[model samples]
Target chain A: MLLPWEYGVRNLARRPLRTMLTLAALSTVILLVFVVVGFIRGLEKSLSISGDRDVVLVYSVNSEENIENSAIAARTPALLAASVEGTQQRFGVTHVSPEMYLGTRVNTDENNGGLGLVRGVTTGAPLVRRSVKLIDGKWPSSGEVIVGQLAAAKLGYDKQDLAIGKQVVFENKTWEIVGQFAAGGAACESEIWCNLADLQTATKRQDLTVVALLLEPGSSTAEIELFCKERTDLELRALGETDYYQSLQQHYKPVRILAWLVVLLVSGAGVFAGLNMMYGAVAGRVREIATLQAIGYRRRAILLSIVQEGVLLAAAASLIAGAIALVLMNGLAIRFTMGAFTLRIDSVAVLFGCGIGLLLGVLGALPPAIKALRAKVAVSLKAV
Target chain B: MKTIANLSLVTAIVVLIGCKPSESKNENTKSSEPTGKQYLVASEPDDSTPVGEARKGAKDGDAVTLVGHIGGSTKPFVEGIAAFTIVDPKVAYCPPEEGCPTPWDYCCTQNEVKENIATVKIVNERGKTVSEDARQLLGVKELSLVVVQGTAKRDEQGNLSVMAQKVYVKQ
Candidate 1:
């Protein structure tokens, strides 16, 4: 007689200790996969969400967006506005914000300080980079500054460090903290923003570092290229905001690949550990299997029963691991050289975890199951 | 044993939680103040053209003289090098009535700040930073009017810059 599905389900409970060890190992592997994949996805999401596809970023020729190395003439923005075609205008004003980007030290206390990226921005800043939204206080002016929600934490500060009405020193000037902003988990959340001229004077860099432009709808990249060619005086190179971040994402490809390698190696260990547990279980259940076969259950039926138990254990463990990852890893701040991005453990990540768990159960049970079925019925029944 | 499984679970959880993210480890140790020393200052700068006009028509290799007030920083060249930004006096600054916080520059709430500025770097015959020549214009306070005479050169990248030969500042 064919054994009922309940028989397979109850078999895992027979060896509680071995089953728990195997489940624990598999669950750990699922957690590892979740973290690795989540990290890469988080970085990509942060960059993509932060930049608008319709905008273009113009930097000095042969330079990155870094302010220390790239020196642009102050007149370039007006020159580009008059020269470049397809630039969007808002309320009779051209949508152009010439900005300065720099990484400088920010004082956490009277005696201690840490590195922070500061953006020198004008009134058009909010229009150009629309992702930034002031959440706590007013926009910064003159000697006042606003910090991103993640900036304080990245600078080794606690919650109270960037509270409004506080003071922190930068550029050798005492800047009163006036506001805090959120950028929807964008990289801008790891920076400080202040008045354009204040930062320029403070850094002794009077020139604008880069010009960000909002292009009119239906504008093409050729327009930007033609603008750069016609105005040789500007000495500028234009990149779509999306392209700029795509290149940044490419820069971190190696790190993401390394994370996958780690997942593979760690999961390999889990698979082998699982295989060992199944081997022991099948050996101890050899007589039980022969008795089932003698009662007219086929070898295929016995094999299916063994594999089902392995998969069921993995599924149960996967649920536990998924819950744990959601609580601890989701929305966790992960800092990098440019800024910090949050780890997101969404439904997609959970589905990936479950898929890997299912694969482990199938592969880990196969060899042991085949070995158990190849045993002769009469000899297997008499063996142990 | 169940204890072994529990121990393994606890270890993995602890390890995952302990791997906290952090900012860049490369710390900036430089002081907040712009670094460098005072250069020489000059009294009674000579005949000059407005900085905005000088920037408009001056061709590459043309000997040009520009008169403008410093707009950005009051600090002397950090390395005693003769390089600074100058702005046209015609540009509007914050009036006392506006209660402007940054009186140093006109960019606080106004538009068109960039159209009035130029960079002046003084270099010797060897085309290197001339600390001696820079001294003649060093320590000149920000917003003080000055005259710079230099050979206008378009850099290989086509950016306009001045290789100043003489820089004079008003007392």
Candidate 2:
């Protein structure tokens, strides 16, 4: 009887075309699974980094994203400051900053047709959050505005762009571009900064909009929430800064779920391909497997050897897929809305994909591997 | 391109190191980062504290104290507690059918009076309803003995009105 390794080699050698086709098909499926996982990983990192851990984002209760839609009457910041029990704020524990989320069109004397998230903020904002960096010019004054990194790129504005100092007109009101900044790699990069009061006038909104605040030491979100409940006229929700961003993920859920659905469908196709190839490979190799059995090969040994070959083939294909994803997909930035983040092909995700592939290979190939061994030795020899 | 990548990597590390300190420091002191000193937990929670009562010491340019969140998107409600200025003797009126209410133009709803604050409804001596700016005139009497603050804007009609920022009950 041939040794176990000898039987595997002879079976694979006999159907070179089928073997190559199965490996290639499996490799493509693994590649797709890796890409989807990579995108999700990159997106999570981008969000956690974009909103600084130090800053608190206040939105109206029951409102998840689009704080413009989450407007708390301009007074919420201070009321929360006074009501949340056990919060520590000293030397003005409350830094009340109003924010307006207005996405509108603006231009430089022409239809530049650029989209912007114009945030109307007060001077107190600079003290509350430290992540907003002004690398050029100065902080926006009452009539002036600051541009985000992405906004600057879209407007062709540089650090020395004196056009910021010059009065530019839009929607009948004149505003000076005073400064530019980068808020990490977050969605804020598409934002425009202006004074809360001035923007109210420019937009003709006399009524105040939502407000944000920073709490000092010894503060808890639960106390603020309880305080909000007592003031039922104003619905309030207080959550930690990290917890808030996690909630923002719900904004991206519909699309992310669609992605996961696509991956599930594609992985089904891979399993189908795997089962078909495994059955065919076993059927075609019955003569060889029976011949080994004819020579006193144990049934368990025959089945185990065939299963190993199947897994090794899938693993090799998966490794190739991993290498491809790492080289071509890394740092491929996706422009989602006004902001963009790179698709990072993380190593841990590669291991996860390959592990899935190995599981599929074992489950799909085992039945076929056992069936071929179950065939009678005399019948197998006669066909050969 | 490679240099940009390297620079970004360094920056990320620096930022990472920077954020850890405050979290760790807070964790060490409070045994939890959730509560400590920034917020004053009331010895007993008081539902009677009008949002303004709790926030009497807020400095300039902060959000006015609100009883609760406004329910809708950008729903504009002149917060009664944060009135920037108070104007009294608003031209309130009883219904025109009520014989013009003896010539006082300002009147209060039962709900308003129960809250110890009346929403000022303004009407001319002839009993014509006016803009909400007239509502501020109602709070003037309520806060004359205390302090109230907010921004003031001229309405379509020229009138001095208060956008109440705060209302304090003076002892």
Candidate 3:
């Protein structure tokens, strides 16, 4: 016969201080699991949602992977719009955008400055980057700029510091923040965007960084690549936007592996902590366990009761940690090399965190409970 | 209650493992079998201009035979099409000590590559480029020396391309 469930629950209350300390320790470990898992999810989501399969990026062949280092002729966009068949078009306008991208020091004030991603784009940018939505104010004109929703967090500044009409200094020119935009949590949300002509004037550049164009439903990326091949003088390379972002995901594989390793290391450490605490708890209860065994309880029944106590404590800790993570870390914007993304405390993270907690409870209880039950019932009962 | 908790624990383990990002799948449409065997010649043309000289002199619709190593960019062959870029043989590959992973790209002489590379496409009677992959059609890979006999097509930008009628792959 099994021990009564109330027996396990009552044992938790018998030693209040030790129980509370164990709960706190378990909660802290589960919270760390929530954070690391959230980070991995956020980074993955940002990259996955950033690309549109129909859009293609045309940049200089020499630039290879880094779009910021790419330079193409200013007329390349016009040429591609005219030459490439099956491009999306409506009302005599083509879905092509010429952009200049760079990383530069952006200063909200004299004291607050950091490396910031900036993109200079034409009106046609919205045509190609369909995910981008202007959330506030109007589009930028000369000497004006627009900040992305997460740009403030990326630049380590308060939202008010980059509010509409506030000035930011970059490229040795002060630009008034005229608008705010969001790109469905894509990396662009961590950049500042401005007028292409204005940025060109400021940076003293005539070349473009890239030309992005959208293709019709049945269109293939091979056609655009063929155009690049045929016009070798242009020195351009075409890549599907989805493939481009997928490549970025591949580039960050090492970081994700390192994150998983951290999760393993943290879980390992938590297991050790749980074992140490359970050993102390079980050592104190040996005589009680012996008394129960003497009163016709099997060793299996006593062990189950001990495990039940541990699992109960862990379940409570999981709830506490999940609540704290949801409140404090969910949607918290964090800066990365590409840009910034929010920590996502979604259902997956919650499930993973709680799973770790329960696993800890089971694993932590087994060895100590087995050790205690192994002693002779007579010797245990006669112990001081 | 114990049974329920065990079940939930198993469910959580399955769900957490399933939480990984789904890999993006590439969709490729296989074209009909190509019948361009006549274009793949058995003998190399004796009078062939170097790809560098052909780029400067070849005109639209002019019959030409050009000889060069099959490479200019990292991906010399276009996907899903019987087309590839050939660079002038005179452009030397980077030495092994340079640690260049793709010497066929001629990264050390990019400017010369820009001037000497010519796109070769095998076209059907409809004047459309063949739908088959070049590697499968020509049996030639990157940096393979070959002779291409085709009609030159020059764009306004002075870029040269060949609508290939025949190709001789050097074994």
Candidate 4:
């Protein structure tokens, strides 16, 4: 027969201080699991969602994967709009955006500055980047710029520093923050955007970095690539937006692997710590266990009660960790080399964290319970 | 009741961890082979022009034979098409000791790469590039020397591409 459920539940209350210490230790470990898993998920989601299958990116062939280093003739966009067919058009204007992308130091004050991604774009950018939406203020004009929602985190500044009407210094010019935009959690959310003409004037650059084109339904990206091949004098390369971000995902695979390794190492350490605590907890209760066995209770029943006590503590710890992770870590902005993305404490992360917690409970209890039960009941009962 | 509830929750989590979402496989849309006469030739064409000279001199619809190595970029071959970029043999590739992963790209000479590379495509009667991989058809890989006989098609901006009729791969 099994031990009564209340027997195990009440046992956790018997040693309140020891139980609390175990709970705290288990909670800390699980919380770390939540954090690392959340980072992996957030980075993956940010890259995956940033790509649009219908968009084709056109940049200089020499630039390879780094679009910021790309330089193309300023007239390339006009040439593409005229030469390329099947591009999305509305009211006689083609969906082609010529953009200038660069990375430079951005300063909110004299002392606070960091490298920030900046983009110079025209009105056509919205047609190609459909995910972007202006949440506040208006489009940037001369001597003004728009900040993405996460641009402050990317530049290592407070949100208030990028507020509307505030001034930011970059490219040796001070610009007013005229607007704020969100890109559906894309990498672009870490960039500052301004008028193409103004940025070009500020940076003294005549060439463009890239030209993004939105294709109409039923159109294939092959046509754009064929254009790039035929216009070899232009020295251009064409890639689907989806394929570009997929390459970025491939580039960061090592970082994700390292994060997973951290999760594994942290879990291994937690299991070992759980084993030590469980051994100590079970070792002190030998007399009580022997008394219970002497009163006609089987060894199996005593073992089940000990395991129940462990699982109860673990379940409580998981609850505490889950609460703390959701409140403190969820939607937290983290800066990366590409940009800034928010920590995603989604359902998957919670499930993984809780699974690890329950696993620790079961594995920690079994060996100690089996070892304690191995001793003869008569000898245990006679012990002090 | 509480014990059963906790056990059920644990069991559910275990089951969920075991269950993975199925991956969606992308369907291959390319046909097995191009619909045309054989594009690979058995003999090398005589009086072949270098890629750099051809790019400068060949006019639209002019018959031309050019010889070059099969690489000018990291990805010299276009995906799902019988087309590739060839660089002039005179352009020196990066040495293996230089730690250049893709010497075929000739990364050491960017300006020369721009001036010496010509795109070659095998086209059908309809003037459309074939929907097949060039590597399989030509039996040539990156940095393989080959001779191409085709009609030169020049653009208004002085870019040169060849609609290839035959290709001879050197051993």
Candidate 5:
């Protein structure tokens, strides 16, 4: 084993040109794999943070952006909540918050104007969504509004300006700034919150737009969906947060899928380059490798040593790429048609990159290692 | 006592017959008057003017039926779509999502049964008459239509952009 590794090291070191080329090819592929995997995982995590595994997003079965568009007859929430006994299995009415939603404009009491989604929430909604944090100020009173942390920044309002007594306006209606809250780092940080009543009055939507339900813990997504399906009158649908994000991930699906395709193509190119480079290295290193085998090193041992070099090169590149992504990509928001979301960088993305690199290293090293091991000792010695 | 009951029944029948006009619930049952045939053609969006001159053409200061989304259609159709359909049923939100109408680039609504070209009317789950709020907040009333009036238009894609003016419910 030691003999083979010593030979492998000496052989790789002797053919500097070939070894460099192979390492370059392997490292480039490994680095790219690291970045792409991490990006997808990070984004998925950020999106998932906003959804509960059991919460169903009941939207117009017509309205794309407005609740008023496909107004579910206001009757649905209650019926779905209590209509069937089995629907609300353990603790009846675990959580139901009927709401009205609209994407509209809001002016921060600050200088620059801010435009974003103004969500009308009922008092009970906060209970259903416990992630909401009251950072400062009080709960929104009637005709009062609460701004998100980032929302405050967008409005040109400093954190100090988001005081409990500040005033904000929307749709020509003056709403007293009541309180502020943050939902960790999820997407909810970009909304203007007000009482459902005030939103109704301002938007002239006396009709509520959406019904959100947080199911009792421990219920499987299939079971919940089955229950929603059974009720015709209720006309409700349930999706796990992961499934919902995946469905919405359809928006980012192209990027995610394209990243893999890009990686695969690039990796293929790298593999070709590495194969040529490794073949040259194997041919050039015939003497050293043959000497090691002649001195009693097993073919498997030599193979393992060469493979280790490839793996180490790839892993190093992955670590470097993952670090770069963490530093540069984190919190960088990508603008979409109606809004923007920042990249969520986490430990998961880094680990994913490492895993990709490890796979690449193993796969990339195999062929060249085998070819070198198969070289006949007598011919290799004679050539050298 | 029996004679009094008999008198009350006769009076009640007479009153019911007299006040039937006030209790008429049907909107599309047709009026008794002679009028031009107004087809409930899918709420058409007309965009002959430039953006500077374009607006959700209101009829004599009244809300126009910008579009309608009927409920439970196998083929998804939002009213006033002359051409083009959203490839993905998601809306890109400008802001991070929060509260009830979490910000999204696009999203689907589950309000009232979409009744394309039907007059916008809101009804409760139990089929009762209630305020739009009681229905909206309670998730009882399905939106019959989403009507927008005098809103701006964006024709970036060369399709006529119609903002919702008033949602109509086909009663």
Candidate 6:
């Protein structure tokens, strides 16, 4: 005799439309969960990965903790050059970059313009940010520009538009896109970089916004804080780059919470649809279920069989959803006011989607299976 | 066997929708030279003190006239307030002869333009933010020269900014 599980599988074959409908619904829900969770994970990773523990940022006091609004005097860098005792030095040059940031509009053509943030960086910038790598062409010089792979996306430029020798117009001047770089999927990949002096002259703001310093292995923020304290003229605050990013992550806690709330709302609707399908399947198969009971199958075995079919359908949907998410959403750059971040569909997101699918299958199947089994065997068998 | 076929069909439909093309062909076009006439045309001449000179340690309550260009290409609107930056031409980090490639900001060069900038807050005689006129100035591009007459005041950081009564954009 065929086993009860095989019988359950056979029942699914008899009602192909019902089975297909249920599976499609479950898969759609699975995809929604994957996307929501993936978005949160990508934003967090983008911010956290941008910082280096050995590096520290110095910004002017009372700038509201916004690097864009902060300004340090022209002589600040020169003052801090030799004052900080434990600063890391490479090739006899101090490992410090006095950087500038500008929020602006970049346009490849009149129809393709968008908001972009550009960074004016020194030669030591790459040293301070070890994760950044020049993937093509050469480092920017003078009016030349080098864009990050994702930053180009935010500016409405595609892979070909950002190719070397292309020109993007901004601030009434043409900047040649000479190179492209990436900083390990960090937020820095949302900005274009050029020689520091060139950007300052363009915006006419000669003051450096912030200075990043690489610290010696044994050194800590205390040493740098002390140096800032001793100088009365340079009232600056020093924070580890990692700690700074952590604080920013905290600031965006509300946004992440909002994302989770959306996931719950959308997933709740999916669950209700799934429950309806399970109930309909059990009611339609009442006679089949009673026949199994009359033929010496235990009530518990009948319930298990019903549940097995639901679980199998859900599992199949989850697998397909995970595969689609991985191929489509992974590494897709999403833009916000601050910058752009790449979506990551890693194992965690995939597992989360599958887990929800399994939970829905069990919860949705239990109620209907128990109800179908509660009906009198004589009445169920006689009705057919 | 039929159950397997139905399941495969559902999966195929889901995959197709999820993997649909997101961007259009026209969205990824190449860079072309800037074209067309100026969007904002100036009808009158503007006269005021240079930004570099006005930023000098003027008395906190001193009234002054200032002339400079908006600094960056990004929307310089001060959120709820109606104010923006006015920068002296000489203060731009790039030398006038070198000419900056992007005029909205001068971040690509060194830190010599530190004292060559001033914020222009649009205010009425009552000193309240002029929300109406401020909204009208949103179309002004960065690096567009303009003139302002207002009171000079020092901010918490000792930077001088103007509380403007009038602003004249140099088209």
DockQ of all predictions against the true structure, Cα-based: 0.05, 0.02, 0.39, 0.26, 0.01, 0.02
Per-residue lDDT of candidate 1, residues A144-259 (tens digit): 99989888756767758778998888888788899999999888898988999998898787788788888888875445643553344565667788877887777776687667
lDDT by residue (B43-109, candidate 5, tens digit) is 5345322221222332233333343222232222211111111111121222333332222112343
Cα-based TM-score, every candidate: 0.67, 0.56, 0.89, 0.88, 0.51, 0.68
Deviation in Å, model 4, residue A292 alpha carbon: 4.5
- Binned by DockQ into CAPRI classes (incorrect, acceptable, medium, high), candidate 1 is incorrect
Model 6 spans > 4 angstroms off: A1-3, B1-171
Deviation in angstroms for B63 in model 6? 45
Worst 10 residues of 1 chain A by lDDT: A223-232
Residue range A1-384, candidate 3, lDDT tens digits: 999999899888988998899899989988999999999999999999989999999999989888999999999999998888989998888999999999898998643677889999999999999999999999999999999999988887888889997999999999999999999899999999999999999999999999999998988888899999999888899999988899999999979877876776677667766777788888998899899998999989988988888888888989999999999999999999899999999988999999998988887787789888989988998888
Model 2 Cα lDDT, one tens digit per residue, B1-171 = 243345346655854564453322111011122121212122322332232332333333343322321111111122322112221212222444554322121233312211222121123334332333312433222222233333322222222222342333231
* Model 2 bad stretches (over 4 Å): A1-17, A46-55, A61-66, A72-94, A105-116, A130-202, A207-209, A222-237, A250-258, A335-342, B1-171
lDDT per residue for candidate 4 within B6-117, as digits (tens), equals 5446655754564443453222122233233387776778899999999888999999998898888777778767888888999998876676667787877878888888
Please write out the lDDT profile of model 2 over residues A186-252, one tens digit for every residue.
6566567888888878877754445555655544443344344334355544455666667678667
Report how far off residue B165 is in candidate 1 (Å). Answer: 44
| lDDT tens readout by residue for model 4, A88-201 | 999998999999999999998533668899999999999999999999999998899999999988988889989998998999999999999999999999999999988899
DockQ score for model 6: 0.02
**Please, what are the lDDT tens digits per residue for candidate 6 over residues A257-371?**
7787666655665666666777888888898889988898888887788778778888888888888888887888888666888788888888888988887777667778888
Residue A255, candidate 5: C-alpha displacement in angstroms: 6.0
**lDDT per residue as tens, model 5, A1-384:** 454345545656676776666666665665566555655665565566877666655655345333335566566666666643223333433466778766666665564465566778876677666678988888888888887755654443465665678777787798887778787755567677888877777777666677776665654444334333333233345445455555666666667666766655565555555555655656666787788788898887777777776666566666666676778766655433323445655676566566766666665677767766777889877774
Off by over 4 Å in 5: A1-31, A46-49, A53-59, A63-69, A73-96, A104-115, A141-180, A184-190, A197-204, A213-263, A266-287, A290-299, A322-351, A370-384, B1-171
